[model samples]
Target: MIDSFLTSYKIILASNSPRRKQFLTDLKIPFEVKTANIDEVYPDHLVKGEITDYLAKLKAAPLEKDLKDNQILITSDTIVWHNDTALGKPVNEAEAFSMLSNLSGTNHQVISSVCLTTKKQQLVESVTTEVTFKDLTPEEINYYIANYQPFDKAGAYGIQEWIGYIGITSIAGSYNNVVGLPTAKFYELLKKLV
Candidate 1:
């Protein structure tokens, strides 16, 4: 099992996302959640995977220096990239509605980046998943926003939620990446550390 690959080290997950936490649990990679607040802001010039990669590493900045040699720190970031723009968490229902509306009947890329840090080394990787949504009606969008409250999710939607059940027409890559982490690719990267 994958846990055997991590037996030498304690794992630290640097994120508050319940979904990400559940992912590690599902993978049976024992880890404890720890988080520090940092401005989610990125430079204007960075695009797509570059943006998420930068943020994932940035999320590790405060935690990496404190890691023990036997502790591995994991940090991640996810963004919905549509029409050359990065869609992040919405601040309100109106913004959430707008984001989902833009995504209606169109394909967008969900980019997630994961960073692994040990006292002596660091590895970062980004994965992108293309998702297509059905043409969403206003009522459907309103219902999802009102009930799911996806203000915390990029693109104002969760691929595991009701919106996904009804709206997502197709997905071209790792579903876990769209959900926030890319477990298969991440498992491959972890092998490098072992």
Candidate 2:
């Protein structure tokens, strides 16, 4: 496995997301977790992938400075883009419902950017997935918010949750990106590091 191949270096993942951690686990890449509170603000002019790439690297900047040559740090960010607007994590139930309502029967892009940093080299990349939802009813959106409490998710919903099972009509790219991380693209990037 990659454990032997990467024996010379230690991998550190700078995220607390269970989904992101699970991705590294499922990929069989050995890594340690480290996190810092970063203000995820980006310039207003940055759109979709740019926003994510900037944020991902922004999340990495603080943690990357002290990294040892034998350590590689991975950081990432995701956002839901619809109608030329970015829908981040909802602040409350009403906001969650409102975000979902706008996404109903519409196509939105799920953009995720992953940044890998070492003391000597750095790389950042992104993947965007298009998702379409069936016309959602007020009742359905209300039920999802009340039961699932999607306040932590962007676009006010988790694609791997009940909403995805019942509401998502189709997806045109990596579902993993929508869930949290872009596993395949991330793996390809990791290969580049080696």
Q: Model-by-model lDDT, in order?
A: 0.94, 0.92
| Candidate 1 lDDT over residue span 1-194, tens digit each | 55676788899999989999999999888999888999999999999999999999999999888999899899999999999999999999999999999999999999999999999999999999999999999999999999999988999999999999999999999999999999987888788898
Best by lDDT: 1
Q: TM-score each candidate.
A: 0.98, 0.97
lDDT of 2 by residue, 126-161 (tens): 999999999999999999999999887889999999
Task: Flag regions of model 1 displaced more than 4 Å.
Answer: none
TM-score of 1: 0.98
Single out the weakest 10-residue window by summed lDDT for candidate 2: 1-10
Index of the highest-TM-score prediction: 1
